[model samples]
Target: MTGPALRPVSGVPQRWITVLGSGPLPGRPELVADADLVLGGRRNLDAAGVPADRALVLGPLAPALDAVAALAPASAPAPAPAPAPAPSDGASATTARVLVLASGDPGFFGIVRALAERFGPDALDVRPGTSSVAEAFARIGLPWDDAVVVSAHGRDPRTAFNACRSQRKTAVLTAPGAGPAEIGAALLAVPGIERRLVVATDLGTATERVEELTPAQAAARDWPGVQVVLCLAVADGAGGADGAVGPMRALAGPTEGPDGWALSEEAFEHRDSMVTKAEVRALALARLGPRLGTLVWDVGAGSGSVAIECARLGAAVVAVERTEDGVRRIRANARAHGVDVGVVHGSAPGALDGLPAPDAVFIGGGGADLPAVVTACAERALRTVVVTLAALDRVPDVRAALLAAGFTAEGVQLQAARLAPLPGGVSRLAAINPVFVLWGTRTAPGSIPVDSSATTAPSGDS
Candidate 1:
């Protein structure tokens, strides 16, 4: 048998790559002087007063990354471990020294992560600047400890929009096409959410501009530089008929989750025991893992019990209920629990169309189109999908649907009974109806070769 090929050894020493922050760069003359290559954005390099000959403009990240990689040491066969080197081993012992320039804190959703991933954490030295979110918050004199920061730069803006819709305070890093106008328009489109938008552009720079505007005003303007938006939730009476408002709490979201989940049947306003039993809900919530920055869907939300509970746990929730009475009960339960659950007055399969994708889904009712509804939810949910069924006949069909949709399927039957008072002051078990909780976790798509000849290409979700 042929011997295994040996791994390559990188002979380069731990040379420094300082990532300088943007705008009037902090004094680090020695580091800059030692740098053989200085890479940064055009504005950042100019502001730092780096020589044109030494500076490389960072345009497309791919090309820039390639340039950076070329500076690494050449590969050779692996060598045996050696003792620590002497102090005489200086800058000559390592590869070329590179210094990178970035805006704000490079460590926070910036180039530091990319550099670390490319050249390992030991190869870098980072000098961070005040994050843009902090500067924006400071400009408006608002406390940011409780503020949630999300980025729409080079990624999906829907999650950021969802964060703004649910959270009391949020800061969004804007991208070229996904800037204030796009984000504001999206928020304006969603009903039942009232928020004020604050836009700060070129913060801490010579051309700094900050403006507070309604969603309509923000959607009408054009923003041309680096910008951030602070989405602040409007108080109950800010624009209500009465000018009175509730006291602002220290924390925007709950400091901790509720004392208990899967609360008593009486806790929610349901019609004719339409809500999922407390025992089953507890198990479902455990599987859902609803929390910050996630969206959960409660399909066939009879009383919206699951949706309301999820909202209480700090998740942005959408409750889909077809009946007029179910919708009213859901709204009432949400209000009673001091939580916000977006109630959709429509049936599934048809209703699930325009809704934002969910992190998890709880199907309490599927109506006539159970198969289609389950399939739709499975396709959209990012993490887990939990389905509740009272009929034993539906078990195999539900399990098969989950398995076919690339989820690892499993289930359990839960039957609970409470101690009831007997006529003679004795107690007896009060048997509750059993429920089957069928759940599935999306399988991690393995590395498989793609065939160009195939009609359909593989998707990220697939």
Candidate 2:
């Protein structure tokens, strides 16, 4: 036999949809008992003692939402000939009540959003419980105000992984496929990444479990019914007190990105002044457009000044520098600025292989092979490419390479004069060397073949 379809009872003038948050049923037991129609997962329905005639097992969201939408006040059938008198509050003797059971705080990444969107806020009576992220952090006895919480349920998990990689503390709400094991396996792929995972499962239940494990350990296990995973950076004296919990935080989430960018030359460590000048770096950064959830490549990263700045702006950055000392400088500079930059010790065009595709690329130094390097980067770059060169002769070749790789190219010559100190407290305009800043925006997505054999000048710092 088919189940009863959702329909408004005659004479009802109002409806209430109460979302039961995580944990045992709260003080509002009558909300479920009196509900004309109930909706929830199997466990929630059973736990709430909903009658089979009144229960609607929640599965695929669309049908359930449609069922609820049919019962809105506007759609209610006309009152019976002898309709019950309306209460002083305007509701009739019979008011339709919908109890929506959800895990944790339904208002937080849960069913409340969809319900509210369909029925409007006035139709809902949301009762929130502690979120799984909050419970996970509480299990470890750590303050969560500073933690970045991201949901990977029914959405791209990469954003969650990147947040964990970039921030010191991250809480990821997990789904079946993107659970702790998957998160652990992805983190294991990042070089020099040091993080400990706290997997919390069956929160607020009799079989509740919360365990801490390294990425390798977490990756090796099959995590069934995992609710949330807390990714914490591994560092000396990180956890608070006797190294189990951290101090409370007045603020929440990761500290904001740096107040400013294009820092002065003194901000980074470079050999023989082999860094992109502050003025040039500023415009290059604007063209690159770095932000959270994006990956940027800084090729020929002499001192990694651009890479460090991009990292500070919240983009995942990789710096490719051929010289051994240059790579060291990049790593050191990244640490000095309290940012994470993946330093690759190799040349471009060839070293570009195997690395993940980038949203944007900045080619700061590519000697005689500048054109070929630009071609290689443009081929894989998803959005834009910006190149800086001191030699005006290479502008045409660089522009051609960009065009060949399906980019709309543009160029400008930037020459800035800074105020210099003269004798007797006087000032003079000290003209800096002119630089050709060429940028290309992809006309469309997809790769184009370009000749990699073209060579310009031998590789050198700009």
Candidate 3:
């Protein structure tokens, strides 16, 4: 399936093949060659439009696509599972002229990729419908082009929540457990974010409805038939777009990872207690490998140096600290650096719950029970853990906990000396105390990957 590229733009409509929901059929679906239409689910969509009897009723999808979970049309029998292609199901005359009926835009986290991943050139077609996501945004009357959209179907909900919480605007395609209710609750528990939750339930249906509430209010409400959610951050205006005046540019697009991290001391913001030393920050980031579509935590984010830097590298960070004053300092630092950080005002462990699950976590403070907190992060299977320690005594305990959790451990002791002018013209090197940085990447067995898709097809939300 991998080739020069899946050039949907260049392909002619007549030659392009795609499956779609009953609503908003593509121009090519009718404009192309005779297509075999399998009207499988609801019949509310008119059968009158099809060339008489040309439409085949494959029956209702009960167990077929679980989203089509309720009773199917009264007229049809139980639907059979649409068998995915076997190795024998190759691109030959036997598999010619294909089209499958999907409840929504199959490409919007549906069956289209099953086709795309398995099929080759001129072997696919697509006509997208207004997904549950598009419908959600439409109900709110908000322009969606500027929103960061994510899907929570068969995937962890944290990445989706983090995207919505950290960005000024976002739309999430929800699954049963990861729907509006769960997303709202997660955001509510976050320390530094304020959001207005909107859930568009049963969109484009008989009972279609929209509801708005505070994150807390939304969390406590009942949700049903909710297909999409827009959990927009309350105030980082003009909506994070291309060319926004921020250091977030490096993370805005796709890029490969860098090798050999532990950068020099000059790369960050510091005012004595202002930031994590750059050498340690680099080690932490390398272990974390924070990038687009990943969530990270910088517990006790003092100057927000690590958290802001992670945001710049394309991760959504939630910086948790105990003091209101510390929160202020982090926010100010975040603004100056041109990145987004959901700053929380609370101490560790106690404040950690309700926050979205992180792909990696960096703990710059907290305390002796810090090992216990790290243990909790491991329990959630956080992909990476990086802790900076000033006290040598705690290193052994931290190392033991990481090992117990099955993570390979590593540490670096970094010390930097700056040139300072003495009373006269002569300069003397002044050394800072060496600090030990402990870092661990979650092993394969511990963490799960996001349902990520990268397209060479130019940048469009769709």
Candidate topping lDDT: 2
Cα lDDT tens digits, model 2, 377-435, are 99899889999999878889999999999998998989999999999999999999888
Candidate 3's C-alpha runs over 4 A off are 1-18, 21-98, 103-108, 130-141, 205-207, 236-274, 335-340, 343-346, 349-356, 365-377, 417-430, 447-462
Measured with C-alpha atoms, the lDDT of residue 462 in candidate 3 is 23
Write the residue-wise lDDT of candidate 3 on 44-67 in tens digits: 224324443434433322322222
The regions of model 2 sitting more than 4 angstroms off are: 1-15, 27-29, 49-54, 57-60, 75-96, 236-250, 444-462
Model 1 agreement with the true structure over 1-462: per-residue lDDT tens digits: 999765322233553566766645444454456677788767767766788877888755666667777776565213435423422422223333788877788787787777778777756656577788888878877767667787765555666777776676778887655577876786665545577888888787678989888778888988888568888876676642111123455664323468888998899988888889999999999999888667889999998889888887878888888898898998889879877677788888788877777889999854456777888889888789999988888888888889889998999999999899999899999999999999999897322222231221111000
Could you tally the backbone clashes for each prediction?
0, 6, 6
What TM-score goes with each of the models? 0.76, 0.82, 0.69
Model 1, position 241, has a per-residue lDDT of 13
Whose lDDT is higher: candidate 2's or candidate 3's?
Answer: 2
lDDT-best of 1 and 2: 2
TM for candidate 3 is: 0.69
- Cα lDDT of candidate 3 equals 0.62
lDDT score of residue 179 within candidate 2 = 75
Model 2 earns a TM-score of 0.82
Q: What are the Cα lDDT values of the candidates?
A: 0.73, 0.76, 0.62
